[model samples]
Target: MDKHIWEEFVELERNPKQIERCEKNAEYRSMQTIRHTLGRCSYSNKQYKLDEESNVKVVPKATTDKWLMGHQRPDGSVHPSAIEAHKKVLEAKEKNKGKGLSSDDHLVSPELEEVFPCKRKDIIRGYSSTMSKKQCEMAAVASAALQNRDTDHEERMQAIESTMGIVVGKMASFQTLLGMLGGKVDSVIQMMIANAAAQGPISTPSPEKGSTTYPAGVHSRVMETEDSAPCTLDVGQPVQLLDNVGKVVALGSIVAGVTVHGRKVKPNERKVYIEQVYDQKALVWDAPQGDGYVVLSQLSLPTWLIWAEDRLVGLLNS
Candidate 1:
C-alpha cells in the first residue's frame, strides 16, 4: 500500500512542467510544495535548508513505520501482519475441523506461523470480549430499555448491533467524503492559482499570522530524519504534512492539518480544519473533524493535480 501510494505521489513529478512553474516563484512556501508532494514536511529539517529535507525514499514502507505493527490498545499489541495471519490461521483451522490435515494444514502463511503459530491455542489471544466501558454501559441501558419494551435478549442485542452498525457506517462514509472533499478543495485552490498565473504572477501575501522560520543555513539533517520537530498544529491554521504514512494511517490512504499561530500540531489534537496556505479561508465540511482531510499548499497544487487526477478523483465515493 505504501509503495503504491509513493508511486501515486511520484507520478506528479513525471510532468516536469508543473514543477517548472513553481520554480518561477521559488519562494520558500512555493518550494515547500515540491517537498509536500514528495511527502516531506517542515520542522523535520528545521536547521537544514529545503534541499536537505528528508524523503520517504519512495520505497516499500518499512515494517517499523507501518502503524499497525505493535498496535497497543488496552487489550494488547500485535505485529503489522499478525492480524491477517491470525485470521487466515483461524479460517484454516475451522475449515479443516473434521478432515485429516495434509497439505491443507499448511494453509497458514508460513512466515506468519513461525511467529503466531497455526493452532488457536498457540495464537496470540487478546481479543476483547467486551467493548469499552462506556459502550458497555450504553449497551446495558439499551438492554434495559428493550426489556421494558418486551423484546427478548437476542432481539435487543440485534437491535443495538444493527443500529450501531448503521451509525458507524455513516461515520465512515462521512470520513471518506472528507478525504475526497479535501482533494476537491485543493483542486479548486489550484485552479484559482493557475488562473491567476495565466494572467500574471500570483503574489504570495505575507503570512497573515507569522509562520515558523528556518534558522541558519542547511538545518540539521538529524531533525529531518528524526520526527522530533518542535512544532504544534492547531485549529483553523494551515499545516504541511511531514510524513505521507500519517495520512495513510489516519485517513486510511487519506490525502490529508493545525491552527493558533497557524503552525505546529497541538499535543493529542488530531483533527483540524484544513486551510489553503495561500488563501485567507474557505468553507468545506462545515468544520473539519478528522485527519482524512488534506489541504495542499498552493505551490504543490499543479504537480499534485497530475497525481490527483491519476488517482481517478471522479471514481472516489460521492
Candidate 2:
C-alpha cells in the first residue's frame, strides 16, 4: 500500500501486546457483564402499579402539579389524585382533537378564556366535578384574571404566578443561588481588606539578647504572682502551664524551633524541632520538652481557638 500505511503496520507490530491487552480487557469486561446478568437471573422480581389506594398515604400527581402551578389550596393540599388529573388531561385532549382548536391548544390559557378560550363544557368536565355552575364560572374568571391573555397554556400558568406575585425577578433559583452567595462572599472579602488597611502596617518585635528561638512544640509558662494576678479573690494554682490546662489545637511531628508569636528563640535546654503551632493567639517561649511539659494558654483566649477535634466537632454539631 502507501508508505504511511506500511509505517503504521510496522508500528502496530512493534506494540503487539497493546492489541492483546485491549482484547483481554474487553473479554474481562464482557465476563463481568455476563456474571451480573446471571446473578440478576437467579432472583425473581415483580413491579406493581401504584394505584389510588396508595394515593391516600402518598402524594399525588395533581397535588404536585398544583404546587408547580403556584396553587396552594386550603390545608396546604396538592392535587387530590393522579387519576383525576389524568382524566382532566384526557378530556382536554379529546375536546381539542380533530379541530382547528387542536392546532392552537398551545395558544390558549385560563386567562385568555375571554379571547382564545377552551370550550367551557371541556373546562367544566375536565375539572370541578363537585363544583356548581356559578362556582366554575367564578374559578374560570379568577384564572383568566391571573394569566396573561396572549400567553400559551404553559406560559399562562407561569404568568398567573407572576401576576399574583408568587415569584419575582429578584427571586433566587438553583442556578443563581451560587452567584448570590458569591456576591455576599465578595462583600465580606472587601470588608476584611478595608479593616486591614485601616489598621496600617504591622511591626515585628525584636528578640531580647541571649534569648533562644522557641521550638514549635515547646512552650514556657510563667505563673502570675500575687501582685500580677487578674484577680486574687478565687485562688487556684499559682504557677499554671497554659497548654496543660487548656486544649491542644494542633498535634504534628516537631520540625523546628520557633516562638508562638514568630520570635526567634535561641536553643537552651529546650528540644528544637519544626512542627505546626496551635495559632498566633498567645506567646510561646523556648522551653525544654520533657515528661509532663505541655503548652497552655489563658482561658480568656479567643472563642475561635479550639484545641481538640472532639471539642471542635461538638461545638459545630451543637
Candidates' C-alpha lDDT: 0.33, 0.34
Model 2, which residues run further than 4 Å from truth? 1-175, 204-318
lDDT of 1 by residue, 38-133 (tens): 124232232133223333221112221111221222233433424664355446544545465433234223323333344544432221211222
Worst 10 residues of 1 by lDDT: 306-315
lDDT of 2 by residue, 1-318 (tens): 576998888788678797897777676454321111212322112001112323331221231122123222323343353244444544554554544344222322332232223576644322323322233233322222234223346677887888767455546464488776888889999999998778653321222211223332232222212332221112121112234333334322212334423334343312122233454353333221222223424322321121211111011111
Best by TM-score: 2
Quick one: best lDDT, which candidate? 2
Q: Which parts of model 1 are misplaced by more than 4 Å?
A: 1-151, 186-318
lDDT of 1 at 69: 21
**Residue 194, candidate 1: C-alpha displacement in angstroms:** 16
lDDT of 1 at 54: 30
Give Cα distance to truth, residue 249, candidate 2, Å.
15
